[model samples]
Structure formats: structure tokens, C-alpha cells
Target chain A: MTYCVGMMLEKGLVFMSDTRTNAGLDNISTFQKMKIWEQPGQGVITLMSAGNLATTQAVVSILDERTKAHDERDPSILAVPSMFQAARLIAKTLKDVIANHAQVGQRADSAFNATLILGGQIAGGPPRLFLIYPEGNFIEAGADTPFFQIGEMMYGRPILVRAYEPGLSFEEAMRLLLVSFDSTIKANLTVGLPLDFHFYETDSLEQGKTGRISADDPYFLAISQGWGEALKSALDQQPTFEF
Target chain B: MTYCVGMMLEKGLVFMSDTRTNAGLDNISTFQKMKIWEQPGQGVITLMSAGNLATTQAVVSILDERTKAHDERDPSILAVPSMFQAARLIAKTLKDVIANHAQVGQRADSAFNATLILGGQIAGGPPRLFLIYPEGNFIEAGADTPFFQIGEMMYGRPILVRAYEPGLSFEEAMRLLLVSFDSTIKANLTVGLPLDFHFYETDSLEQGKTGRISADDPYFLAISQGWGEALKSALDQQPTFEF
Candidate 1:
């Protein structure tokens, strides 16, 4: 299982994904789930995937291979004119990969499905974020729904719902995501560190910033411990129930 | 859907349950999920259920009727001599009810299955808590696993895992539970207001303090709002990530 969240805020886009993947309790491994396609001043796109490891890797391989092909026969995600078209390309690739795998004796209902979060900016357009489903359909983040979460989402969702603001700064958004991810890691073993984080500023048309947070990262440790203590202190301050 | 939690603490036991039940988003109603059977000085058993509303209601009705029946030929839950025995009685009754309903043409896999949290104390024995499955088998909460939650549990679980301590006072436990429930309610539409809470002191062997917290209740409102602000404040206080 994986846990990933993408937010579309006034400042830009924030993306985070856990690296833990497991076939079973005893077969756990660390694998990066975030992929970036950059065209310097032209455009920048980031994709984070969750679901079957094999399927996600296959989708990424197909997209990466297309970008390096000598022939201009196929359009790569990096060459897509807009973020919408980039998302469409990734969705189509994902569906074709899953369908091809299913046709070769594997049941489609098996765990070979993958969902993705695609977000970035094209030089002339504003930033955008989308959640691409395994069925190849996708939905863009709108004013009413400013964020999208996939895989092991429920454990970390309350904080996002309660604290998310439309105009948060990049720093504040990262802090919020850290707290949310910490809560999930504490409550569930399937989702572990290190975590991948990306920050994209609207219209920059360049790879903004990216980093990895591991189990012993000082800032993450502080947030995890600080949030727990703060919650207990808050509970202590609340009025007790009267019988 | 429902959300219910039962915890066995050093001081005693704490049980909290939401009263919302819904077959679909359009069809929502309030229904109590907590049931108590107390012989005052002899024993006190509390049952909180989640899952199929009809199955839970049927199980409760059967137990209630047996306690009221004057005939000695049928053994009632009230006659159970120990907390373990009481749990067995409830589990057996629950399995029987589900089986009986299945025999009437409904698929066994239908929503007619219920999961329950049973906690209480009997004179001359230590307090106990059990999670009864639909198949009539149950597992008691122990030192390693001190609490049990059923139905829409993920949203509220992280807080419980972070803050729960066996030595917490009854008031502290209730506060913890309120924060957990508030998290659930904020994140999910299926778990709603008018929560039922019960507290049983060890060796008291009597019905404990119980109450309901509705949507407009002042203390509940305070907890709900205060927790959100507290979380945001905590996030602000955390050290910002350096790129």
C-alpha cells in the first residue's frame, strides 16, 4: 500500500508520497513513486502513483521510454502542450498498460491497478492538479475540492480537511502534509518512510524543489512528536463531560 | 454506517459510539447502538454495535426480550455469571440472528452482518472487553491491544493510537474519545452527532455514567472547534522544512 496527497493552493501545488510498498507483510520494499518531467522554461510536470508496484513501474517505464525515443512518432509527457494534455497522455498509457497485462492471463480485477496524481504548469497557463483513476478517467482539483488523496487516505484525511486553507504558503503546506503523513505512519504500518515531496510554483515552468523525508529526519521527528503533545494538551484544555 | 470504540483502561473501561445509521446518503437516521445490561452490584455489561442496522437491532431485541422473559427454560444474557460468559451469550445470539436472517432468502454476504464491542465488569472478577465477530467468535482486549473500534474507524484511529494510555483518568479518556470522534465526524458523513458515551469504574460492578452529546451541545462544539484550531496552531509551530 502507498499514501499520497496532492494539493492545489493559491500559492501553487504541493505533492507528497510514501515510498513503502509491500506484496505482503513479510515482503516489504522501498520504491520511489514520484516521477518528474521537466522542460526548463517550457513546462514542468510531476506524477505520483499508488497501487500495484508492477503496474505503476510499467506505466512510468512506458512514459520515460517515449521521451527518449529518436522518432517523433509519439508525443512524450514532456512535450504535451498543456497540463491537461499531459494528464490525458499519462492516463491513456496507464490504461493501456493495465489492459495489456490483463489480456495475458491476469484478471483485470486482480491487484494490477494503479491510480496517479498529475500536477504541474505550462509556460502560459496557471498551475493545475489532477487525480487520474485506474479506469483512465481523471478529475481536476477545483475550488470546492482543493486536494486529492489516494491509497491509505482515511487515516490522514481529518487534518487536511480541518487545517487546509486556500492561500497557504509553500512552507505551510509542506508542514501540513508532514503532520498528516506522520499521523498516517503512526496509525498504520503499511505506509512507512521515506517520503517524497515536491513544490511547484505557478507559471515558473521549471522544476521547483523536491526532497525526501526519512524515518529519522529531524524536522519530521519534531512535527510527529510536537503534534502528539499538542493534541494531548488540547484535549486537556477541553471541557470535561458532565454526567 | 456507525462508529464505535471501546477501551479498557487501568481505571476501568470507556465506551463511545456515534448514533448515525444510513442505508444511503439520502436515507440517514439516528439509532442508538449502545445497550446496557446491569444487575447493579452483580455485573454491568455494555454493548456497542456497527454494521447492518437491521441485524444489530435484531440482536439487541433478542437479548432484551430474553432478559424480560419470566421463563427459566431459556438462559438469558442477564443470567450469565461472568463478563466472558456474557460476551459468549451476545456473540452466539448475534451469529444466530444473522444465520436466521440468511435462511429467509437473503444472501449471507448481504449487509446483515454486525460487529460489536462488549465491555463490562462482574462482581469477583476483573473488568473485561471483547470484540465479537459476526461468526459468534470474539477476542478480548488485552494489554497489547487495549481498544477496539468498528465501522468507519480509520479516521479516528490515529489519535487513539497516539494519545491512549492505560493510566488515564475517566475524564481524560472521555476527552480523548471526544477528540477522536470529532476527527471522525469532520472527515466522514456517515458518522454523526448525538454520540453515546459510557464509563465504568473498576470493581464498582454497577451501571456507569452515561450521556449523549448532540450536535448543538456546547461542550461538544467547543471540542470540535478547539481541536481544529489547535491542530492548525500545532502545524504553525512546527519547524518548516528546508529545501
Candidate 2:
């Protein structure tokens, strides 16, 4: 039960992912779901995954291994020519990992499935965001749909749909994500703290800024409590229904 | 798809259901999902359903037919002794309907499945609310969980969880439900107008106030717009994160 969201705003890109993972209620653990690949002036790519941990980890391991390979023939995420190509590489790696595990005769519906949010900037192109499916296919965010959310998405979606604006500054975007994530964590136990966040400026072609938000973080606490109180106040302000 | 929510508050019980029904994106229609049975001075029972429209309609039809029968020996929801018994009657009828449909070799997971939120009051007892599953089993809403939602629930759930209070006035409870439904309608295509709302006052031993809210209703519009604006304003007020 992960909740990861990525936005392709007019200014740049914003990505956030929760760290809690669980096979069952009793076997809960924390695991990082965000991976970053940067080439400074060349480009920066951020991948946030949700679903089976084993499958996602395997896909990341394969990509990392290729990036470190001495042979120039080996394809790597860093070697991709564009954001689109980087999405394709991650999608392909994910599909291959799932297929390899399925070869052991596991059912097609086996839990070896994972979905990813890939967003970043390439040197010559605008920042782009994509939602990669388990089947190795992906869809890019467009003007009509400026964001993509995977895993435990519904609880936090209304807020995003109502408030998201194309020209929002990176600070405002991160604040929006925090409110969204706060709603999710309060409603669902499977999604919890130690959240990973990354912001990529359009032409910076670098990692931009990144950080982790834990449960005790003052800013996170302020947002959670503030949002709740604000909602109650809002409800009080609304006109009552007449019968 | 449907979205129906029922809450048990110290003042009484609140029930709301959207009227939209759809087979797919191309085939959509409006169908009532709330049914009420009242023997003034005796009891009042409200049933809100979600899932296979056919199955739910059949369950209601069967219960209605039995209650109209002139024979005294025939079992009927009207004859149930307590709210618990009423819940059992609805559950049993629901299970029988699903089983009859399955005998024709339809898959168990067929769209014949339905879920319901049943709540009301009978003479000499406090109000009660139950969530009835397709299998005919049901669970009552307790102190810890005073509400039940079926079909497309997640989007509207967080607000209900955070703002619900056992002692809220009937007006406050209805207002809370409107906000919750407003969120659901904005986020989901399957749940829409007009909404059916019913309030059952404790020990009233009769159906309380009931009304229908259509898409253009002034009150509904106000809540829908007010909630969106309030949420955006709240987002603006939150402290931004530092990276």
C-alpha cells in the first residue's frame, strides 16, 4: 500500500512517495521508493514506484547495474537520449523483471506487479511526467491531466484535482503534495511517514532539490493539524441544509 | 458504480445516496438507491444500496412484495422485532438473491453482487446502523466507527473520519455528509446527482425528514463550490516545506 504522486507543472516537476510497505498487517516495514539518476548539466530523472517491493527493487537494481557497467554497449537510464526514452527504459526494465519472475510458473495475476511515476528534465526538452504500467507501457501527463498518482490514490485525489494549477510555484506544489499525503496517511494505516520528495526545475537539468519528511517533522505536523482544523472551520462556515 | 454513506450520531441516523448508475462510460443512467419502510409509531428502516443495480432492485422488490402480502405467516421486514432483526432480514434476502442468480452458472464475482447500508429505529430501542455484504453477513457501526460507506468510498472517507463526532447535531451531520458527497462527485464520474437524503431521529419511531438534491440545487451547488474554495484556501495557508 504505497501512495506516490508526480506532477508536471508549467514551471517544473514535483514528486512525492510514502515509505511504508507491508506484506500483511504484522509484517510492516519501511522502504525507499524513490530513485534518482542525475548527470548535472545533462539531465536528471526521478522514479517513484508502488506495488510489490521485490519486483520494483529488482527493476531498480538492474538499472543501477547497467549504469555502472564498464561496457559502452550496455544501455542505462543515464544513457537515454530524452525523458521519453528514459520512461521507455524504466518500463522495459520493469516488464522484464516481472516476466522473469512469472517464468517460475506463478500466475499472471501474481503479486509481482509494480507501477511507477517517472518525471524529470532533459537538457533540451521541457520537464515531463509519465505513469509506467506493469505491462511495460506508459502514458505521459498532458495539459488536461497534469499529474499521475499510483497506489492508494483516491483518498488524496479530490484535493489535488480541485487545487492543482499549472503555474504553481515549486513551494506551492510541495505544499499541495504534503496536504494530499497527509489526508492519505490519516485515512489509511498502510501508507505512513518518512516521505520522499523531489523537485526538478525545467532547464536546470539537475536533481534540483530533495528531502525526506518523517512523522515528527514540524512542517508535516503543522500541515496535518492545520488542514484538519481548516476543514472543520470550513464546514462550520457552509450554509446548513434546509428540509 | 454508486456512492452511499450512512452515519449513526447521538441525535439520530443520517443516510445519503447518489442516484447515478452506469454499465460503462457509454451507458449511464439515473436510478434511486435509497428505500424506506415505515410503520409510524412502530419503526422506520432506511436501506441504501451499491453494486449490481439489478440485484439490489430485486432485493428491494422481494422485501416490498412480502410486506404487502395479506398472509400473516409470511416473513417480512415490517415484522422484524428489532433493528438487528431488520438487518438480518435484509442480509438473508440479499444472500438468497445472489445465490439464486449464481445458480444459473454465473461467476461468484459476477456483477450480481451488492452491498448495503441499513439503518433505522424501532419502538423501545436506540437507532442502529449496519453494513450488509453480498454474502448476507453484516456488521454494525460501533462507537469507534459510526459510519458506513459502500462503492467508491475512499475519496469521501477521510473527511468523514476526521470531522465526525458522536454528538454532532442533525444539521451538522447532514452538512458533513454533503461535503463528503460533494468530494466524491467531483472526483468520480460514477457517483452523481440527484442525491437522496434521510434523517431518522432517535425513538421517533417514524421516518424523519427526507429530500432529494439535484445537480443544480442551490444548497448542493453551494457545498460543492464552498468545499473546493475552502480546500484551496487551506492549501494556501499551510506552511511551505523547505528542501
Candidate 3:
């Protein structure tokens, strides 16, 4: 399983993903899920994927090849003028990739296909976040739905639903994200440590902050420690029942 | 779907379960999952189940008959001197119920099995908690593992993992339990409001502090509000970087 989250906040976009991939309990491996496309000051976009690791990697490779092969004239995430167009392009690319693979071999089902979080900005457009479905169509994040998550998501969604706000500080948002991810990691062995992510700032628009985060990373450790303490104390203050 | 938990603490034991039962998303109904069989000074045993209502109901009904029949001749949870024996009896009963039903026109893979949390104290014995399996086998909660959860449990486990202690005050434990349940409710529509439960103090050997909880309950509202604010603040404090 995997965990990828996209937070479309008032300031900008926050996207994160865990690197762990496991075929079984003993066959765990690290695979970076966050993919980025950049054109310096013109455009910047990130794709964080989950499900059917091979399919995600295939779609990403095709997109990357399109961007590199000028004569191929294939539409690409960085070349798209608007976020909507970029999302549509991604969906089409995914659909095409799955179709191409299915024609030669396996079909898309529970074991195959992919889901992705596409969030970024082109020079003239506002930052947007989209949850691209397996069928390829996507929904943009709305104010009421400020964030989107895919794969192993339920474990972390309560925190996002209960607390997320557009004006949250970058650090504050990171803290919430870490705690959410922590809860997921603790409950699920498939969604492990060493997160992969990129945080794209609003007009500063480059590929953004990127890293391979570990369990012992200072920020993650702080959120985990602070949250555990908060929960303990919060429970301590509630009224007791009379037997 | 359900959210049932049992905790064995130094002070005593706490058991809680929601009453919601659903045949499908649109066809949800209420059915109490908690059951108590007390012989006052002799024993106090409680079981909270999560899974197929039919199978669990059948198992509990038979267990009820055993106690009423003065089943000293056959082992029963209420008649067992040791909590471990009680767990074994509960498991064996569940397995028997499932097996019998499966043989008579029931679906082969019935999804009819249920998991249970059985907790209480029997006079001279210490408070005990067991996570009863769908197969009728169960494991006792240890000092390091003081609690167990069944059914739609991942969403709510964060608080319990963070707040639980061997000797937490009853109020603290209950509050933590509610917070955990609230998280479960927010994430899964199957496990719902109007919970049914009670706490059993060690030697009290009776159903103590029993109640039916709803979404509008005051204590719950307070926890949700406080938790939301705390989470937002915590999220806001995390660090973000400029691309």
C-alpha cells in the first residue's frame, strides 16, 4: 500500500508520499512516488502516485519521455498552459498507458491501475490540486475539501478533516501532515517510514522542497512526541464517570 | 460495521462499543454489541462484538443460554474461574456457531464471523481483557498491550496508542476512548454514533457507569472541538520551505 496526500491551502500546495512498497510482509522496498516536472520560471508540477507501482512508474516514464522527445510532439504536464489542461493530459496519459499495457498483457483491476495527486501551477494560473482517479477523470480540491488523499488514507483522514484550514503556516501544516502519516505508519506495516515529498510555494514556483524523510527525522519525531503528549493530557482533563 | 474496544488497566477494565449495524450503506440499523453476564460476588463478564450481526447474535444467545442453564458441566465465560478460560470458551462458542450455521444453507465464505473484546473480573481474579478472534481463539491483553480494538479500528487507533497507560484515571481512559471512537466515526460511515458501553471496576463486579452515547452528547462535542483546534495549531507550527 501507499499514502499520498495533497493539501491545497490558501498559501500554496503541500504534497507528500511514503516510499515503502511491499509485495508481502517480508518483501518491502523503497520507491519514490513523487514525480516533478519543471520549466524554471514558466511552470512547475508534481505528481504523487499510489497503487500498481508498475503502472505509476510506466505513466511517469511515458510523460518524462514526451517532455524529452521534441519530435514526438506529445503533450506534457510542464507544457500544459492551465492546471485543468495538465490534469486532463495526465488522465489521458494514464489511460493510454494502462491501455497499452493491457493490450499486451494484464488488465486493470484491484491488483493493477493507479491513482495520483497532481498539484502545481503554471506561470499564468493559480495553484491547484487534483485527485486523479483510476478511470482518469479528476476533481480539483475545493474549499470544503481542502485536501485529497489516496491509498492507506483512512488512518490519516480524520486529522485532516478535523483540523485543516487554508491559513495554516507551512510548519504547522507539516506538523499535521507528519502526525497524520505517523498514525498511518503505526497502524499499517505497508505504509512505512522515509516519506518522499515536495512542497510547492505559491509563485516561488520551482520544483519546491524535496526530501527522503526518515523515522528519526527531527520534524517527524517532534510531531510524534508532541502529539502523544497532547493526547495523553487531553484525555487526562476529561470528566470521570461515577460508578 | 462497529467500533468496540476493551482495555485492561491497573485500576480495572473499560469496555465500549457502538450499536450501529448496516446491511449496506443505505440500510443501517442499530443493534447493541455489548453483553454482560454478572453473578454479583461470583463473576462479572462482558463481551463487545464487531462483524456479522447474525453470527455474533447467535453466539451471544447460546452463551446466554449456557449461563442460564447453570453450565458448570460445560465451560462458559461466566462460569470460568480464569479470564483466559473465559476467552477460550467465547472463541470456541463463536467457532461452533459459525460452523453450525455454515453447514445449513449459509454462504460458504459467510463473512459471518465476528471478533469480540471480552473483559471483566471474576471475584478472586484480576481484571482481564481478551481480543476474541473470528475463529473463536483469542489473546489476552498484556501489560505492554493493555487494549484491543475490533472493526473499522484503524482510523481511531492513534489516540489509544498515544494516550493509553497502565494506570490512567477512569475519566482519562474514557475520554481517550471517546476521542478514538470519534475519529473512527469521522472516517468510516459504517461505525457510527449512539454508542453503548460501560466500565467495570475490578471488585465492583457489576455493570458500573453504563450509558448510551449519541453524537450530540456534550462531553463528545467538547473533545471534538478541543481536538480540532489543537490539531490545527499543531499543524500550523510545522516548517515549510521555499522552492
Candidate 4:
């Protein structure tokens, strides 16, 4: 299980993904699920995935190889003309990876399915975010739906729906994401720190600030504890039922 | 889909369930998922169910008929020796309903599966809570886990984990539950108003208080709107991230 979210805000795009991966309840490990591909001053692409680890890793490795080997047969994500094209390329890679795995062992196709959130900007296009399905189709986030979440999303979604504002600054956005992640991590064992995040300043066409939040990060700890007390206080303020 | 929660508190027990039932996104209707049997001063039993509506309604009907007809073959839930026996009786009835359906028409057994939360007190026994599964087995909630939620639980669970207290007054407990339900209703279409609630006071050996909170109920409306504002204010109080 995993939890990844990408928000398209006025300042830019913010992405966060948990590292924990598990094959079963008893078998778990930490694996990076966020990948950033950037050609400074050209294009920057960020992909966060949640699903079968092997399928996601294979898709990422294939995308990385294409970028590094300068292979004309397969264009790099950084070479895509628009964020839409990059999403299409990633969706195709994800579907192909799942298909190849299914054929090898003749396993259920669902076993190798993966979902991804892709957000980025190319030199000539505006910043965009998409939720790519395992079937090679995708949907973009726009004004009405300004964010995308993949993997173990329910526990953290209500807060995002209520607190997210289009004009929030990067700092406020990160604070929101951490609060969202904190709610998820506390409720499910499958998602945890250290969380990885990247910020893409709108129309920059370059890599933006990025950081990893370890388990003991003071800010994360404060948010986790503070949110609980805050929620309690919030509840206290509501009118109690008279029965 | 549904959302039903039963919390065991120091004062006694509190139960809440949403009334929305859906065959698909387009086919939805209001169906009460809560049943109460109270032999005032003898015993009081409350059952909240989530899952296949047909299976749950069948179980409730069967239980109801047995109590009404005074059938020798089927005992009334009110006649159970203890809260544990009541849970066992409910679990077995649930399992039989699913099995009977599966044998008649070769559909997946999971299609008929239903989960239930049973909480109450008998004249000689203390108030207790059980989470009954479709497999004819159930587990009781204790100090470590004081509540049970079935169906569409994730969206509403974090607040319960953070706000529930054993010493809470019935009013405060109901307040906590409304917040939990409001979060779920906003995040999911499958769970909605009107909400049903029941309270059993410890050692009362009888039904406590029960009510229905319709969508337009002023208190329900206040909590729903007030909670969002409180949450935003809480978020504002948190220190912002520095990048």
C-alpha cells in the first residue's frame, strides 16, 4: 500500500509520496516511489506511483534508460512536447510493464496493476497534473478538480477537500500535505515516513526545490501531534447533540 | 455502501449509521441499517450493519419474526444469556443468510457478505460491543480498541481515533460521531443522511435514548458547516513549512 498526492496550486505544483511498500502485511520495505526527471531550463517531470513495486520500478527504469541512452526508438519523458504527452508516455510504459509481467507468469492482471500521478511542465506548455490509470488512460486536474491522489487515499482526502485553496503559498501547501500525510500514516501501517516532496514553480521549465522528510523531522512530528489537539478543540467548538 | 460505527464508552455504548444504500452510483435509496431490540429492564440489543443490503435486511427480518412469533426453533436476541451470546446468534444468522443465497444462485459468496456491529447489555451482564463477520465469528472491543466501524470507514476514522474518550458524556460522544459521519458524507456519496443513533447507559439494563438526525436537522447542519471552519482554523494555527 502507498499514499501519493499532487496538488496544482497558484504558486506551482507540490508532490508527496510515502516510501513504504509491502507485498503482504508481514513483508514490507522502503522503496522510493517518487521520480524526478529534469533538464534544467528545458523541462521537468515528476512521477509518483502506488501499486505493485516491481511494475512501477520497471516502468521507471525504462523511462530513465531512454533519457540516459539518448535512444531515438523511445523518447525521454523530458523530450515530450507537453505534460499531456509525458503522461501518455508514462501511462503506456506502466501498461506495458504490467502486461509483460502478466504474460510471464500467467498471473491475474490485477496483481501487477499500478496507478501514477504525473505533474510537470515543458518549455512551451503550462504546468499540469494527471492521474494515470493502469489501463493506459489518464485524466488531468483542472480548476474544478485541482489535485490528484493515488494509493490509500481515503484517510487523507477529507482534509484536503476542506483546507486546500488555489492561492496558497508553497509553504502553506507543504504544511497542508504534511498534515494530510500525517493523518494517513497514523491510520495505516502501509504508509509512512520518510516522505519525499518536490515543488515546481509554475512555468519555470526547470527543476524546483525538493526535499525528503524523515520520520523524526520536527515539523512532521509537530503537525502530527498538533493536528490531533486541533481536531479535539474543533470538535469541542461544535454544538453537542441534545438527546 | 454504508458507514456504521459503534463505540464502547465508560458511560455505556453509542451507535450511529448512515441510511444510504446503493446498487450502483445511479441507483440509490434510503434504507435503515440499524435495528434495536429492547425488553426494557431485561436487555437491550442494537445491531448496525454494512454490506449487502439484501443479506442484512434478511437477517433483521428473520430475527424480528422469531421475536414476534415466539418460535421455538429460533430464539429472540433479547433472550440471549449474555451480550457475547447475542453476538454469536447475530453472526450465525448472518453467515446462514449468505450461505443460503450462494447455494440458491451460483454467485460469488462475497456478493452476499455483510458485517455487523452488535452492542448492548443484558440484565445480568455489563454493556459490551462485538464486531461480527460473515464467517460466523466475531470479536469484542475492549480497552485497546474501543470502537468498531463497518463500510466506508477510512474517511471518518482518523477523527474517531483522535477524539473518542471513555468518559465522554452521551452528548459529547454523539458530537464526536456527527463529526466522523460528516467527514464521511462529504467524502463519499454512498454514505449520507439521515443518521441514526442509540445510546445505552451502563447498568440500565434497558434501552437508553435513540434519535434520527435528518439532513436538514439544525444541529447536524451546524456541525457539518462548523467543522469545516474549525478544521481550517486549526490548519492555520499549525506552523508553516520553511523551504
Where model 1 places Cα greater than 4 Å from the true spot, the runs are: A108-110, B108-110
Residue B31, model 1, lDDT: 94
RMSD of 2: 1.5
| B93-196 per-residue lDDT for model 1 (tens digits) | 99999988888974666668999999998888899999999999999999999999999999999889888999998888878898999899988999999999
Q: List fnat, each candidate.
A: 0.78, 0.84, 0.48, 0.92
Cα deviation of A47, candidate 4, in Å:
0.5
Off by over 4 Å in 3: A99-109, A237-243, B69-77, B106-110, B233-243
What DockQ does candidate 3 score? 0.43
Q: lDDT tens string, model 3, B101-215? A: 7788847675877888998888787888888888777888997788999989888887788778888867777777888988888778898888877778878877677788888
Using TM-score as the measure, name the better of candidate 2 and candidate 3.
2
User: 1 or 4: which has the higher DockQ?
Assistant: 4
For model 3 the interface RMSD, in Å, equals 3.1
Q: Model 4 reaches what TM-score against the true structure?
A: 0.98
Which run of 10 residues does model 4 chain A get worst, by summed lDDT?
Answer: A70-79
Q: Which pairs of residues have clashing backbones in candidate 1?
A: none
TM-score of model number 2, chain B: 0.96
Regions of model 2 farther than 4 Å from truth: A108-110, B108-110
lDDT of 3: 0.82
| Chain A TM per candidate, in order of listing | 0.97, 0.97, 0.94, 0.97
Candidate 2, residue A196: Cα displacement in angstroms equals 0.5
Better of 1 and 3 by TM-score: 1
User: Residues B1-243, candidate 2, lDDT per residue (tens digit)?
Assistant: 999999988889999999999999989999999999999998899999999998999999999888887884367887888899999989999999998998887576667999999999888778999999998999999998889999999999989988999999888888899899989988899999999999888988888999998889998888888888888887787777666
i-RMS, each model, one decimal: 1.4, 1.2, 3.1, 0.7
